[model samples]
Target: MSRLAYGGDYNPEQWPEEVWHEDVALMREAGVTMVSVGVFSWARLETAPGVHDFGWLDRLLDLLHAGGIRVALATPTVAPPAWFYAAHPEALPVTKEGVRYGFGSRGAICHSSAAYRQAAAGITEQLARRYGKHPAVALWHVHNEYGVPVNACYCEASGEEFRSWLRARYQTLDALNTAWGTAFWGQHYGDWAHIDAPRVTPTVGNPAQQLDYARFTDETLRGNFIAERDILHRLAPGVPVTTNFMTALSQCDSMDYWAWGREVDLVAQDHYLITDGRRTHVNLAMAADLTRSVAGGAPWLVLEHSTSGVNWQPRNPAKRPGEMARNSLGHVARGSEGAMFFQWRQSRQGAEKFHSAMLPHAGTANRVWREVVALGADIGALAGIAGSRTMADAAMVWDWQSWWAQNLEWRPTEDHDARERADSFYETLYDRHLTVDFAHPEADLSAYPLVVVPALYLATEAVGQNLRAYVEGGGTLVVSYFSGIVDEHDTVHPGAYPGALRDVLGLTVEEWSPLLRGERVRIEAADGSVLPADVWTEFVVPNVPRGAEPVWTYADGRAAAGPAITRHQLGRGAAWYISTRLAPEALDTVLAAAAADAGISPRDDLPRDVEVVRRTGEHGSYLFAINHTATEAKVPLGAAGTELLTGERAAGVLAVPPGAVRVVRAD
Candidate 1:
């Protein structure tokens, strides 16, 4: 029988030996088939210098196996014992402010430090050699989240290393100088020694230098991850290796997970609910979609989330009665195979004592534990979703490089946030109840019927070529303004506003008009109705290519009579460009038209608060309808099928209660 790995971070080492037995009993009661152990146990596993102790871990693993629980054994390299850091102080990470991180907390080691790397390799080798073939070991959990606290290291050692990395990338100082455009401020570098990691500069440092530093920081973390991964691959052959990632790309900007995703066996992420009294569940759906995309749309895992409220956020609100189950299964609806909380048992001491766990501070007699058990049963019943993948009809372009470069010192407007812009388009699609995936800028665009590129401020020639090919080959493309305007080096293209895509878009922007934060502008739609716009407005003289026309023009402003939105027809497909930020309602109107052109229909039968996602299984497609509101919602399944949870034949209308979910097998 298939089962979802149901338990979470288990720190038995922190408790007494007598408590392990009770924890096992509770684990069985909660239907936890697996638990991740030894994540923060590095200090305990290694008492002193090179001396190691595995007796405690050996007993714990054996006990878990006997309890019919599998193990996602973790390499405790995330937090090295204080002894190692004391022995090799040079391995400590330096902050942007130039202070070496103390050893009290986790994630204090420098990824670029050779001493840290050597010590990591030693511990990893020991763990793999000892537990690689253990019967209880099911998966290899690599070091915890890589760029949590110490993503960028700015010490002299990192400075030297960054110079070396640049030398290898550009191959010559002259090339590096040219790529950075060092002649602008008479700040040309004559040799490799002059370049640093962009640490504590008098003014805003060079955009190119900051961009490269972000890349280097990403690579360094990946290097540390790969060092441990290689050891496990050799010793624990066939056992999958993975590391948990934080919520979104913007949260950990330094790590390029698109690159890191290729290294892990399967993608896993930690996402906490945002209960700010808004449409917060949309954020959950977005995060899950991104994780599935990172896993190539395959089933992945939720390595860590809270059972109730997390202690970290400023005002962590406890989830309502049924909200937890809805949140967990929501991820499953988006191709997550498992949903595990941050911990198995609540901590009585330490930093995260209040972070919710399977068993809260109050034992299994409480509502949280009952909900945990019910959710476990629900997940186990739907094990048929294990190998399923969520198929999306549309994709939105997302890139960390573009996000990093878009935030450079000099820009048209400070309101241009790459993630927010991309999400604005995504929010419009979501309002239309259309499923979407997050696609890399240069990824294969053939699979998607419609591709939306929002605020792609720092586009590369290769990305532009890919997009052009996609449009010319019968694919619909929608690009926002400020895109295709610059090369990868943050250098603006010579001609047209969107230089690489000007010909395809069939418009030449003569000048850009940026608005202040609260300023508002209006655009005249094709219907002669005025619509609201903000942040940016471009004045374009339409050279109007053979098959292109201006769809929306500025009504009456400084940039009046210019194109605000345009549509073009290539060989067999079409492209649309929005030249300014629009209100959500106006943006939805624009996207609704583009979606129609692509033959994509919104699920109008379902309420907007009820999210409907489809995943294909061997039996058939499973339709999950999740209601995120506080009231009951009636949804039309559009097919005759059995609701998997209650085993009732749900034909047309399905009633989903507030904060609940319904999974139906489509007939």
Candidate 2:
């Protein structure tokens, strides 16, 4: 625990017995201190029902311990053996169309199945009792990415569980009916028996019903995790228990991490780059920031990321020279205990054989292997930052429940993507060199001088009041379109369009005017600068008397002359609202202005793509300057310091090489 943890998932069962020793040797050479084991070894561990085999695992753990590497022993519940599926076929998940999934890939079991739960609990108990006090074990990894591949299953068992969950949540049919708005299509559930999982429906099923189903699925999966976690807690006692989470919004969107964050002893996340021709490092920063925020600003780990190109994407391309180190250190700079990849050794067989790993298929002679060894050394040198917390200048509102509701069957336009808006806003903040902490809608915002809500389609009354109080307390607020339109139950707020936020924003959306694909519009700011926007526009009525000023007007669009963007001076602070999806450049201007309003000064001296973040701990403050551009980036330092990466003395200015990362410990 004194040093940063490195290494990745170690699947020794995939290789021959003789390779284990060599694997350990290579691990030591790569500076690996810890690894995750038994993630997909359920079948290998428990060969048949009522039978167990511990000889191999015991030997492997001993080998790892002897090699000075710690084990994050995982319960192989993610992929139950085929024998289990054969015995309890009902445990297999069924699709929304009622097709039962076969036991080929991982995460095939229905979380709500009693048989699966019992079996998973049994395996977890066995693992805990066997290795709870083992010297090799440092952490208990419950499952491999809880909500990946499949989040919800529409099986008969899930149906019954859904009804039970609804009973607990709503208490009665009338309350459930009202919450789900079942009276709309004369689809009121007269009894619990009639209610079922929101399966394939005639047209668009009830949005509220779908929304609740998403919640139910998340809770159900989390319940399985909790069941296993309880076993570990009871038996293992002190060792930290965690289930790696894919917190990056683009990868996984099932579990509400704010809830999951509170359950685990430590927060761990898996983030992979999306090679969609965007600023991927910005996404990496956002994911890291979000994970740290979920961990309550405590240091967390990058449980799984690609060492180079990932195999699952549409196109897999190897990383450029020094890119691997940059990616790993980027996460470390944002409060990660250390960086870890999906695997230590590349597989020779299996679905993920092509996936990049610490020890790639090209062996230790390639760029990946060399970088892996180099990154290990760098991580070791920066071990003093283990418990440090990343500093943030602003907070952004993000909620999985709201994202689920907004992603439902029908909306103003299919082009209106909440994740895109969030990404855009986060990217703008990143460009401004502002580190952001993501907050739940109802979380306290007083600590942050500025708060941005990118796309919160489902905003509870409490969230509206929270934002109002924040702005009234002299905090700046910026909200994008389609927010505050629906409540927690996915019900449209009564009265004005942006129901709950109307008062705080000082504007009412009369009607949404969504443009067709490829359609664009021009909005003229007060300074006569025209900005182009797309995706959507709204008929906005500003509360002029209440200090709502039209900052940007739709110059040429269906909502022409309407406020495209409005700024409301409420109490001692201000709230800005954007009624249309502005281009990234336009968004940058608005966000820059809002930042200035909140008394936040962006690091204007840094070049574009140069990210500067600070991590502070008992070891003193460390400033991380990452240069993503192809030229040297000069970062202005307020005090003299030594660059931890190279142990070079630096004062006033820190020059970061192109496509590299530098960390300076302030003297």
Candidate 3:
């Protein structure tokens, strides 16, 4: 723990025994402090039922220890051996369409199957017992990404499990019926045995039922993880146990990190860029911030990212020169203990053969290998920042449950995407050089001066009250459209639209007016400035008695002359609401005004796309200035310091080359 953990997943089992010595030599050359081993070696290690082959792993760990590198020993339960599936075919997951999945790919086991759970536990315990006291093992990697590829199943075993989970949650069939609103469509269950998993139906299934199913699936997967984790904790007493999470909203949405975060001894996440032509660094920063928040602002690790391009995407392209280093350091700047890629050495033959790795197929002579060495050295220089906390100026309310509900079958418009809204708001904050901490809706808001609710299509009464109290307690609040419209049960809040937030926002939405695709509207501010908005418009009636005032009115739309944006003064704080989706520039303007009201300001002195963040801890303060622009950028430093990357003294201002990163240790 004295140094930042730098390395990637090391699958030595994929290579011959002699190749490991070379891997170790190259690892030392690249400054690899730690490497994860045996992530997908279940079949190799457990050749037969209850039989394990540990000789290869034993030699590998010994070699790594001799090379002065630590190991994150994995349980290798993610991909069970082919024998497991042959014995317990019932363990295979069945799709909602009634087709059962066969085992050629990973993560195909039904979590509800007792046979699968028992086998997974056996492997985990075996690994723990064998490597529990290994000197090179520094951490216990419970399993690979929990919710990747597959997290839900519709098998009969899963059906029974779902009923049990429901029984525990609702206690009685009557209560379940009421909660699920089964009275409609005459779908009420007369007996417990009648209830089944929300499988493919003639029409859209009950939204409440589907939401509960999602929750059940998350808990089911977490239960499996906890089962393995408990075995690890009991067997490997001192070692920390963790399961990597895909915290990026775009990548994985099945697991609720707020719930999962509390389960792990350390929070670790895997983030990959979507490469959809948007500013990818913005997404990276958002994912890092979210992961840090999941870790409760403590430093976390980048368990898996691409060294260049991944093999999965539609048009995978190699990262431009220096982009790999910039991408890795970007996570470190936002509170990662270290950066790690999906793999150490590229594979010669596999589904992921084309995936980028620390050592590509081109071997040590490639740009990837060279950059890998440089990045490893750079990370070693940032050892002091390993445990530091990344500072945040504001909190953004985000909940995976809400996202799940918003993505249900029917809604006002398919254009209403929670992730898009969140990305837009987070990107705007990023552009202003504001670090954000994502919080669950009901979490404490007193720590933050400003809180933004980007899109919460599903909000419970607790969430509304929490926001109300936050604003009343002198915290500034900004809410986007389509938020606070429904309760946890997917039932529309009674009375007006956005019912839960009406009182706090000091406005009532009588009806939703969704714009057609590609349609636009214009809103005019009081200063005679106009901005275009799109996707949605609303008929908002502000409560004058609540000290609510319109800041911008609809200049041309279905709600012309109506308030497009309003601000309400409550207690010593203010709440701002946007009744429509504002353009990015317009959103920035509104957010800036709200930031000023909250006594925060943008870092306008820094060049555009330049990210400036600070990490402070027992070691002292460190400033991370990452230039994402095409030209050199300068960042002001109030004091003199040593640049960690180059070991050069920095004073007054720090000049960062284009596409480069600099970390300064404040003196």
Candidate 4:
């Protein structure tokens, strides 16, 4: 069985029957082996209520099977038939502003709506029963990207559901009140009726209330996913089910993917390049790494990414020649089992008419189409790379709940974005050619010698306890400022600013000074080199436990006399605290010190534009060397082996052209 599942979302129902023949021929020519169908075809599948017209889908599947392609049949639950909302208006999702969204857009139904759940489950059951034993069906794509448009439903039903969820989480109203700190400002709730899902409030609503709302919404969506997934599992026993995740680019508070990842059979991602005209290969790599981690260090899938440009962004810039190939191969280099796209053919009419596809508007003559064919063939040749996992020596901590809590109201500064902070640290490690795996805050930290946790603003006692044990167990922990300051409910921990971490760091932060826009403070390292600091700074008073020491301090600021960076040794390992946001150069300096302490030597001698990552399997190890820059460069192969892409004999030095990828099994 070839594990490289190439091809993409194929919507043959969108075109006439004659076009389907041409699509099949092109699919084979492009070396496509799989096609995802019926993702947004609820109207075609179910015309009115339960009256399903799977006639079109059945023909589509039969034709695809005849063409020797597998199907990842999707339940048309993303966009319900227009008649569904008309028959049941309660299915509509209300936004935080209390406005009910219309049915024209996808994901407009509330996850908390029982009617929507029943309808979704009914359709999924129908699909599974019909295609469960079909020869063409290989996988089940449960629903399209969940929570893309409206993640939260601030309606009366959601409020009732929120109360129910609270009851389940904290049995009694007294327990709920205590957990939410409702006693503040005479807001103590005597009954569960007082609770709502944090709608349009006059001022910053209770932080605990808002936090619970986020949790409730995520669980609600997960419940909906499980409902559909269960139907598929029961009807289609052996078929693996998955849902596409928006990954690092997702803005929805609902759907904690770490929790959702555990439920899915395979972790899949839908990543589109940043359309702001910025280079995004590194961002793509990071998302793939996180998805791989969520999959328990196994190979996953790239369910959907634009073949060229996407329509949603403010300006949809087309990918340059070979850029798409580079992007897809990058994901595969990390741990993607396959490389797929948003669609097989371009849409003639729809909101996403401008979104690029495998067969573009220019037809077979276009450069995008040519590149797509080439990429498909290239991906097919690397079938042996399947089942191989990218081995990483370092891990980065990721918490979706903390992402929501860190961006709430009434913070010391309004500029604390946890994702940006984490990405910065990940980029530093990538530049050093160190592979990084994203681990949950509570995950086993013993696998990696170094762990970098950034801006974990909302931390629990258990999280702190876990990191303390990890460091004491001989692992290096690098935690940033504004971390471990708040408990799970968004309540500030008493005593020191960095609450539980103060003990592990052997320091206590007395006060915090948030920097204004354009304001900068200089931090001096032991080497007398100064680095600019911004956004935030904590005035630290280190207790300096017997094994702890100071690393850096503010050269001049309101907290100029305080320590800026402190390190403490616990058992055999050590923990370092960065008290402020250091400039890029300064951050490198700080991370360099930690890297050195962890005995991780930076692999910096390679060409600056080339990226090297290794994946090991039972067959041995394969090295993926990618040239991200535009110019050609000669890279030293270090060992001689056969290049998997071109089947060329690669010796001591390999000539890598711009936007090229070489997968070699070296000696």
TM-score of every model? 0.97, 0.99, 0.99, 0.98
Residue 319 in candidate 4, Cα distance off native in Å: 0.8
Give one digit per residue, the lDDT tens place, for model 2 in 195-293. Answer: 999899889998888888999998888888888888999998999999999899898998999999999999999999899888888999999999999
lDDT of each: 0.85, 0.91, 0.91, 0.85
Please give the distance, in angstroms, between residue 400's alpha carbon in candidate 2 and its true position after superposition: 0.7
- Tens-digit per-residue lDDT, 483-508, candidate 3: 99989889888888777888789888
lDDT of 3 at 204: 92
**True-structure lDDT of candidate 1:** 0.85
- Pick by TM-score: 2 or 4, better one: 2
- Model 3 global lDDT (CA atoms, 0 to 1): 0.91
What ranking emerges by TM-score with the best candidate at the front?
A: 3, 2, 4, 1
**Model 4 per-residue lDDT tens digits across residues 231-252:** 9999999999999987864334
After TM-score superposition, the amount by which residue 518's alpha carbon in candidate 1 deviates from its true location, in angstroms, is 1.6
Q: Which stretches of candidate 4 lie over 4 Å from their true place?
A: 249-253
Candidate 1 on 1-667: residue-level lDDT in tens?
1587788999998789999999999999888988999999888888886799999999999999899999999999889888887788878888887888777888887888888888889988999999999888889999998888778889988999999999999999889988999998887998788888788877878888888898888998898899899999999998899999874643566677788888999899988876666566777888888888888887889888888899887899888898889889988898888888899999999999989999988998999999999988888888777788897879998887888898878787788777778667877888888788988888998988899998787777788788888888888899998888888888888876788778677777888889887888899977888899988898876673374578889986678888888888887788898988887899998998898888887667877778888999686889999998888989887788989888889987999888889999988
Model 3 spans > 4 angstroms off: none
What residue runs in model 1 are displaced by over 4 Å at the alpha carbon? 247-250, 545-547
